[model samples]
Target: MIPHLWNDLEGTFFPESALDYMPEDRLREVQLQRLKAVTALAYDRVPLFRERMTAKGAKPADVRRLEDVRRLPFMVKNDLRDTYPYGLFAVPMSEVVRLHASSGTTGKPIVVGYTAQDMDVWKQAIMRSLYSAGFRRADVVQNMYGYGLFTGGLGLHGGLEGIGATVIPISGGNSERQIMVMKDFGVTAVCSTPSYFIHLIEVAQKMGLDFKRDLKVRRGVFGAEPWTDHMRQYIEAASGIKAYDIYGLSEIIGPGVGNECEYQDGPHIFEDHFLVEIVDPATLEPVPDGQEGELVITTLSKQAMPVIRYRTRDITAIDIRPCRCGRTIRRIRRISRRSDDMFIIRGVNVFPTQIETALLKTEASLPHYQIVLTRKSGLDQMEVRVEVTGDMLRDSVGEMEQLQKRFARSIEQITGLHTTVTLVQPGSIPRSAGKAKRLLDTRNEA
Candidate 1:
């Protein structure tokens, strides 16, 4: 059986690498070997890893199997912040081939280095992610996920090149031109944040561009933020392409940690290079199978800065079951929200995504919405401001009022909070080409 409905894509998917097809037992063996080697590297070269491991009563030799990774110390973003630029590099500056840093918008940027081999692994992982999303040599991929200091741009550039696709390093912004390139250049695929793609839909509509008739893109790889199925449907319908979710963090190997295959079941976590664990964010212990918790990852193949059980703070559940794509790697539930993003209002935990999911479900409401949290009269108030579609606008006032009441009920149903849903005119909500800002709490803004 071959996937040939879309032209001669006889082999759009790369041959399963040993990492992709290795048996579970053999994969575990490789993980153990790499884990032991990295543990030795971090313990011997980096004082921080050695001190932490020594304090935890574990030595490199003590970690004999993949299960032993739990005994080793956990690495947090603060560890990277504490080390600053190169404190955790296993190799010297001369051996390090590249450097990529986080935005550090909150505070100190977490820096990561890559040796030549580390870079090679990164390229391979990205290729795996692309292959799963149906990327092939014949496809021309537009790398729009930012470049420089941030790993999304260059990492994806190298990845598309590795997969033998024609790479377009257009970067971000210039929404109209991006759509123009897609129309004129015969661009076949795209990778960017889901929110940005939705914005592109708006841009295309404004340009009077018809995606199905005017675009050649067959599939899209969307990542960098948590998007609901409502968002996916909106993007797919607007772009006329099957949408796939990609998951990664700068601390890990970037956007290739996992991706959705054509099956689109879940993003396959590349367990061969990165060992993933779902754990209670508060307790720092592994969670039950198929349970939702924080995502923790340990870099088994990284040389410059191998992370051991680094707490990702990303909330997701490991499916434990294999994917329908036939890849043995375990899959992770789409990222719901980060633990830090979880805010309890009136004893009910709520994430901005919850509101987005609820609003997107309503046909009359546009995907653009904002959750404004404020303290008024000594009580926390949650108000969801959403845009109404043009059809809803053209309708009578009674119709709009009923839709608004429906949206309010849906929000209350999802977040267990009595809420206010304000319907706004289209284009009123700000659209971001990067990560969409969804939450604003006036109580904490001071």
Candidate 2:
């Protein structure tokens, strides 16, 4: 890795990007200034924000310092849905140049809007993200993130172009064509979910294309779903590409809220434009740095739809220690699970990521797996159906039984809940072009 690429924050060529390297005192000064402005904007324009603040007996004027951010009303996912199409918008529809919404599989999709200035800030954030990961203007990036209402595709697309990188706008799916494009176009970088990238690795192997020898891909920017460090290691080892974890949400300006630098230690949050806080999901109280909690963000620079103390629901901690990369921006622990994604099995809180950690540790099976939750005799049960590698599938029946037992033991050790491990043949588990669906809860089924 070229550590010298973006080092020397003082000598940094780009002046607009210098906020990342400012001193902590100066960073907080800027954050406080933006915080006051955004809160006032939301309070004056967005009725929902204003109503919540009023109910709490707090006004924009209550924000005296950074700590006073707690005085502002908190915004949750339901707020966006309750507001529906445009209730939370701080500006009129005419000023909104773009609109993006969540999948809303549960109910009404949470819609978010971006003005022209908002679009510019989003692009700059992405450009900073890519630069932190060692991406330069000469890199060829294949953006496999899905486009349209989903912000992943177009978000990265615009930013990659903003940095002057040649982009292959191949929105998710079409794995075969994706591989072909990488081979023929001399693609050096790729942007997609970590799960989708694993699928690409499998496709390339089937087509007899080696990543290290055949593809010029040296770096991968992966996000859109929670993934573990084990998964990151697996991706890098299997594909021979450095994998960087990026963090963001649809309500918080898409995927450029924070990103991993070349060190891959943690993703640095862009403090100048976004104020981040770790709050206890249950108590809603702030947690000290280095302690895990729900991530809350305030869009400091967003003009069209600025959200205040927006609850992200993703669990992580902030690292205030200086990074080896010399950026003053703080980094967040990689998000592997969300509060809403946790499921209780027989009174034991279990996250899908815990199951993934166990499954990946085995190394005898592929990462393609699903958790099936069922209830029998009024007791919760979990059945892990994981796909075995071709070599493992060819093993004798006794070996397969041993593998299954090993998986069950590993899961029981970590989660303290015994599970039925069902080893399936290769390709039995469904693959996804976007976010991989890892959980299939049938306990509620009649």
Candidate 3:
């Protein structure tokens, strides 16, 4: 296994990692200063921001303290849709150097731009993320994140190079090639979604390769979707590597918003560059620390597109307590649910992660599963189709029936809703190299 860059005794990753361990008072002061400047930039340059602020009778000058962030109007996904291509950008096209976008449910994609200075800050954030995850210059990292319009690939790619780590820019897919290259190059680290890594583990197993014995990879930085501790435990047990959760969105600044240190308790938000607030998704009121709510963010250093009070809709809580890693930045609970992904069935609210948590409890089932929703008798019905191990598949009918009943019981215990559990073969579920589509709502489909 490759050694991590972190120094346990010194409580620092390296000499340049001072910003992460700065005093809370000092970090807050820097955040406030940057917040004021970013708000002012948006108010002056973006008409949408100006009109929204004016309607609320608030200006950048009104931002006297950090709490004044509430005075600023909230921005949502529609704000980006209404603006289209560049409506929310704070800088001119001449100054903007790059553009990245995520596919929207409707017409136009949610696009975000980055100026040269913005790119530098983004890279610095990614570098911090890598260092915090114990990545070092000596480690060979195979970046499996998709490149191009998506921000995951290039974001980590640039940071890996910036940190002097040798990178194989293998942008997603080609599972056999990915594993072959990993083994040949003696890759020590990987960056990708947890789902993809799990798929890789399965693929390696099928190819007669043991991750713990045949592979040299020791660390994995996974993000771009909400994963659970159960999934983490599965990955660690299956493949001998410490999996770290990373948080970010293209609207704010790609995958550098925050990341977990060696502690892996939760990911620490880069407070100096991005301001985080957990608010009640319904009322839009700020919630106290340790309480779960929607995660909202304000980009303080982004020059191209500085979003103000942008609601991320991710459900998580903040931990303001100091960490053993000595970083002053606060950490957020691992995101397992999204405000928009919840569906109520039989008067019970259900998130796919709840089902995932339940499905992972049994060793007989693989992590691959799908939730199928349909309307029958004007009522919603959920059927979870999960892939079971080959041994379970080859078991006697009586034994298989018992396993199915056990799975249904575990799921009901967690969700309080009974679901039809159908155990399929291992490779029955479609695998995705990017974000896994776990939900299928055919109720609305004709």
lDDT of 1 at 7: 27
Question: What TM-score goes with each of the models?
Answer: 0.95, 0.96, 0.96
Global Cα lDDT for candidate 2: 0.88
lDDT value, residue 423 of candidate 3:
82
Where model 3 places Cα greater than 4 Å from the true spot, the runs are 1-5, 8-13
Model 1 C-alpha lDDT versus the unseen true structure: 0.83
List the lowest-lDDT window of 10 residues for candidate 1: 1-10
Cα RMSD to the true fold for all candidates? 2.4, 2.4, 2.8
* lDDT (10s digit) by residue, model 1, range 1-446: 23221222763445544367667788788888988998998899999999988898889999877788889888888999999988988898999999999999789998999999999999989988888788888898887899988889999889899878999999989999999998889999998898888888777877888888888998889898777777777777767799989888898868889988777877988888999888898788889979999999999899988888889888999998866556677899888688877788988989888887777666623467888889987888988888776555745888878888888988888888899888887778776678887887796654
Per-residue lDDT of candidate 2, residues 367-398 (tens digit) = 58899999998889999998876656644888
RMSD of 3: 2.8
What is each predicted model's overall lDDT from 0 to 1? 0.83, 0.88, 0.88
Task: Assess candidate 3 and give its lDDT.
Answer: 0.88
Candidate 3 residue-wise lDDT, 270-337, digit = tens: 99899999999989999998999999999999989999899998999998778887787899998988
